[model samples]
Target: MNEELSARLRTAAEAHQPDRARILARLERGMSGAPDRHRESSGARPWPRVALASLAAAGILAGGGFAVAAIVQSPPARPDNSGTPAAPSAPSAPWTPPHTTPPAPTTGGPSAPDRSSSTSPSPEVSGGTVSARPDSAHVQDGPLWSAGSLDASSNTYWAQSDITLKTTQPLTALTVELRITQTGAVQSTGHWRTLPADDFTVTVQPEGAAVVYRWTLKPGRTVPAGQHVFAGQYNHAAGRREAKHDGYRVDATGPRGALSVWGGFTPAR
Candidate 1:
């Protein structure tokens, strides 16, 4: 029984050893092929890594191009002493002042005459008479006139005459003379000479107005002789009359008498 058991054990051991050898062979083949697969996987891994890196580099370059385009499109910066950019300045307007107006001018009227150089009044004469010789004659033997007595009539008589003197000299003196006579009744109580009343007036008609020289004569009055005997008598009537052309007039009033008048001028030197 023991021998039979040993034979059976030996046969079983032989069978198991063959099966185990086949399994070991299969494992060895699998192990040898593992290194080749690992090499292939490692090579494929490096290609994926290189492709990812290239994609990342292209994205970075595209971003840099966009940044440069933005910088080129923007405006240039103004320089300042500080590091900051300056703001733009606004435009200014013109300046002006307020306005004003001026005033207007005034006007006036005409003026008056000056009274400081007016002439004075004439002086009175004494009863005496004077004689004068003229250097030149103005009038001689003018017509005579008469006035009746105051009892017969009260009418006054006047005569006027014009004469021109020819001389190239200045005259300083003027004289007038008259011839007088009396007529009509004479008595012891009232003689014709005693009863007659007479008045004589001589006038110089210069350029402007008549200037009068007067004498009141008695029946037989005497006259003194001189130059410029009637010099200061002017405007004795205190009135103005029209002047003749370089001439004069005689005016007489009496009760009963006849009178004749003559006049001339004297040279200055």
Candidate 2:
């Protein structure tokens, strides 16, 4: 019975409320030929909200794709704050091995001249004479006093006299003096000296008014022998092949008919 009474109460409430038709009628009146308050208040349709949400989602996706593309694809290089781009470095060159040859002996004898390398002495001035003098000489101990023995005393002796002459032909009357000295001997006397070649191998020339004479010392030999004074025509000169005890080499090519070389041995100071 109580259940029945509650049902009746609900029925009564329904009866007092308007029917669906009446509700429809009220809505039509509010909407008929007039602006809708709901539409006016919102200012736009509700569907636009959905469209805006979709557009926003698309924009976000595009921006994310662009960011990913910048990382994967070529990215613009950033410049340094100094406004200059960095340059790539050059690669290093490969190392080469050092050449291997033993260094030449440092303390060996005089190097042999390279014959293959054509090397000539400086062109000697024509008609000029060059000579050499000894810097020092020593008298050997003991006396086997021969003219040659004087040469032994002269071991410390050397002759050097350089003369140059510029003449159309060889100079005539070229006089060379070889100063001989003896020590460790009981007595000092004059003796004869010799030259290597007596065929006027020693040439003379006029280097202006001054006559220049030159003689080269042969290897393993010291003094040149023969005539003391060499005199002859510029083209054809004569020398002494054999010297006399008086120390004079015969020369027939002079105004005196015979020119003599003058020299002697003296006590060394």
Candidate 3:
């Protein structure tokens, strides 16, 4: 009996064929709590129902477990990123500072251009000799100088002052003024200079307590280097009029700067 049962089991297993429609029908009836109509129609025994259920379960596992899961379950949740070891991040590149251009080199100061070799030259006196006047009252200042002499030809009724100026350099501008202290009815007679008459503007006027005679070189005109003379003639009351208090002022301009000289006059005894 055991051998025969084993043989029968072998034959049943061999004859078993997986039918999706039949298995699903059975599954549907079981889910709906309805009797298995096919089993009742065939008058199959209860064990046959058990066998069908078991075979159905086996068919599901063997044939269509993945297919059933694909139909029944929702799409798998997005893969969990937390547990997975993150792909090794590509090695970070070395940091490098931005390239910078340095500021241009600078100099301490701008090189000054070379000016004239010298500002003031050794005092140059062109025709350079100075006149000898033993009897004259003379005063000198650097390159610009002046001298005064009382004219011997003056009579008791008149007196004269002769002024001489010497300059080493050609004078671009010159002004000579003589002030004779008024004594005994002093009055102007005339005035003269060695420079061209047109080169000077002469004026005789009374200033303060003295008679002033001025010679101004005209604009655009120049006095050549050497000695130049200017004279003032005036009449005074009968007696000898002392000229010790007489004075002179000279203002001259040269290439670099101005020259000025002024002093009182001493007539010969």
lDDT of 3 at 86: 50
Local lDDT at 223 for model 2 = 27
Clashing pairs in 3: none
* Per-residue lDDT over 67-94 for candidate 1, one digit per residue giving the tens place of the 0 to 100 score: 4444445577657688675776786776
Scanning candidate 2 in windows of ten residues, the lowest lDDT window is 140-149
Off by over 4 Å in 3: 1-138
Score each candidate by Cα lDDT: 0.31, 0.32, 0.71
Question: Which candidate ranks first by TM-score, i.e. highest?
Answer: 3
In candidate 2, clashing pairs total: 28
Best by lDDT: 3
What's the TM-score of each model vs. the native?
Answer: 0.18, 0.23, 0.48
After superposition on all C-alphas, the RMSD of every candidate to the true structure, in Å, is 35.3, 23.1, 21.0
Model 1, runs deviating above 4 Å: 1-45, 76-269
In angstroms, give how far residue 54 of model 1 lies from its true place: 1.1
Which window of ten consecutive residues has the lowest lDDT sum in model 3?
124-133
Predicted candidate 3 versus true structure: per-residue lDDT over 34-77, tens digit per residue? 67654455544467666677787676645454444343454756
Predict model 3's lDDT versus the native: 0.71
